[model samples]
Target: MSTQYTYTAFLYWLLLAGLIVFFLFLSWDLQLFQTIFVQDITRISSLIFILFIAVSVHCGYRSWFVASQSLMLLKIKKLSLDDLKLLSDDAFESRSVIKDFLSKVLNSHSEPDKTLATEVLAESLRGAHQVGWFMAGVVIKLGLLGTVVGFVLMLSSISAFEQLDISDIKELMQQMTLGMGVAMNTTMVGLIASMTLGIQLLLVDRCADRLLLETIDFSLSTVDLVVDNRGEGGAPLSAQK
Candidate 1:
């Protein structure tokens, strides 16, 4: 499979951004931002928004990194051994998983060790998105924390109940409304942010997988050639047994 998975990833991100923008505009028109973010005393929704923005930026950068790796894979697939050797270290992109695997393959004294190369590549790439995945889950947990806090606030309003004075009843009602708003708003924002980030990371993972498989295939075929005269008294690799 050609590791041209970057195009699909890019299109998915573009559409996702457009949808988010449309909903944000609608929310602004409806004045829901003030209700969900500004009025809540807990400010959990605001925190969630901030965290979401940070994760989104990280995920975008990761996507670009994967795309660059894909392009490099395509380049390596086309280049001959002499061509690859002639190219300087600076010619390949930096911090590329494929580049690392390719370097190891070319520098190996014997056939490329596919198992070792794949393990290294997998671990390196997994680290790239592991933080984003963890943070996405944290966003959901923060929302749940807000829910607990909101409920505590609501219960506190009734904790000092004494004969329900007219003024006391009005104050209790106001507190209850604020508490409910906080709970609902935070939960809603958390779910949305977590799901969005999770999807983006999922796409990045898929692209990474394609890149890995294609790289392995390319290396085995062209880059990781077995020594044709190694097995027994100058036997060729194919006639070795």
Candidate 2:
């Protein structure tokens, strides 16, 4: 098997790091952190910011996990039944995703079920990123919520006006400015957070998909069940290949 797929996680993290660096530079250049966190009275931007970080971290962990499983799959792809049995005896190696899967195949007395394994792999590999995707959407909604709150704040200032006077005009403008800032800042933060986290989770999802597909192929072509063909109604190992 080509080892090219094993680099997926490394490349993903490298690209992610580059993006983070660029974004940090941009934030520092524009003083964005202070503007969004310090200037906003509603603090929605802060919440969104924190959630984005959390979601991103989770995404990174998932990516690494899927990648590790892929590596393990590659390692044992050509192992025979006896070889797999020897590996499974090691406590640490047996804990790996591919090892656990092969253990199931090795122990089954019935026909090897590739379809069931595919479903199991899909759930194990691809399902991990769903939470991050959801949270990314929440970040965007939070930003919009900030926008609505800011607009309300702006409108409330206007409502307080008994009459248009120069002194009151200055105060009203300040209040309106504050409200607008809240709306714009929150909206901006939410959008940035959502987009960044969405991109990361999307990459994780793709990596997971690739891992699952490759595992399916490997299982179909390589892994063989250790069962008696005539007695147990199981196909011969050669038939599986």
Candidate 3:
């Protein structure tokens, strides 16, 4: 399939992914959702948007990062000039190289920057949020299109009879129904996905915050170990939990 078709297919798949995630949340426990509904609707919407951002970003980075780990992608932040040259060269041998390079670039951790956790979270989220933005725009345009078509149906119902025919009224109602369905489907799905995603994102964001805290602790106490090439001496991976 063409790249465009493939991407479009992924968007559809993302919706399915969102549905699955929702069901999984319910299976795990649905009480969390109840608390959210009690809050303001506007707040709820914002939360949903953020969820879309988080899920998309987390998922996008997870796919690539997990794959790179199998190749023993240690010291991603330490790639040298030679590695850069290898990456930039026309002679690069593998499709995986670009992905590796990206993994390294995104994984960078330098001095005086924000905590590694924050940077990592921000960098990883770009692609997913991009997808979310595109989907949101599509929803808006589709909504508008539905609005226009609804109007057309209303106008079409007013024939030269100058009096409303029962048949015309029935036909107009059907046309309006179809038009409204086409118009609102995207927006409704977008909003719902956005809301569900928002809730998921809050859980993730809080988790990330906690992880960042642990990472900071690791950085402070293990600065010597990390800088001395004793990365394994840092805190246990599960410390964040």
Candidate 4:
């Protein structure tokens, strides 16, 4: 991939930007983090959010770069039917390029190229794009925890032996507000992250599928030509596989 728009480079910048945003929010909302417990939870949520975004970008980049290369290969006016098969083989299994990591376990079999390609595509789709599904579960658990803690503190504050006073009421209000804030913040953050990641992943998956289908269609046409007994006597891709 080109350095100017490489996914890895984008991830480096994105993570830096995310950290800056997280810190800026923390700095501005310093009151929220004044409680040690709030600070700890926020930090952990921020870490998970960053990981999802990084993975999403990587998946998108891989899909685009491979599709772009495949299109270029298809453009050769003199490309023989066998050439199409070679292109598919080279695109999925060539090991010299670091991008070949997509084929970490290439094997020979029926439609092996498409199988390996789909596996890589599926892995990225699940790991990077489905982050929202996982986070939704996490956020619900955390939100429930926050709510329980908040109510417990509410009961404790009221039960203090000292007769309830204005100061006491004010403290209770603050505890309730903090609890609501924690619950709402985590839930909102999880939803927002999941929505964005899901969209990115969906787009990447579609593009990859489109690329593979085009390649397969082209290769099948080539195979038919080779199999045509009355046509030009050309060798089938089977000879090389």
lDDT of 1 at 63: 72
- Give lDDT per model, in order: 0.75, 0.74, 0.43, 0.47
lDDT of 2 by residue, 5-76 (tens): 786875786689688879878997998787778879998988997898788778778877877787777667
Candidate 1 lDDT at 55 equals 86
All candidates' TM-scores?
0.84, 0.85, 0.40, 0.54
The sequence of per-residue lDDT tens digits that candidate 1 reaches over residues 1-241 is: 2455546556666677788779889998999987788757878889999999898888777777777777767666555454555234765555567877877776665544756777888776657799999999999999999899988888887886866877788889998988888888898899989999988889888877877787777666554243342224433322322
TM-score of candidate 4 against the unseen true structure = 0.54
- Please give the clash total of every predicted structure, in order: 0, 0, 3, 0
Clashes of 2: 0
Clashes of 3: 3
For model 3, what is the error of residue 127's alpha carbon versus the real structure, in angstroms, after optimal superposition? 7.0
Give me the runs in candidate 2 sitting further than 4 Å from their true place: 1-4, 87-94, 109-114, 223-241
**Predictions: Cα RMSD each:** 5.3, 4.5, 13.1, 7.6
Ranking, TM-score, top scorer first? 2, 1, 4, 3
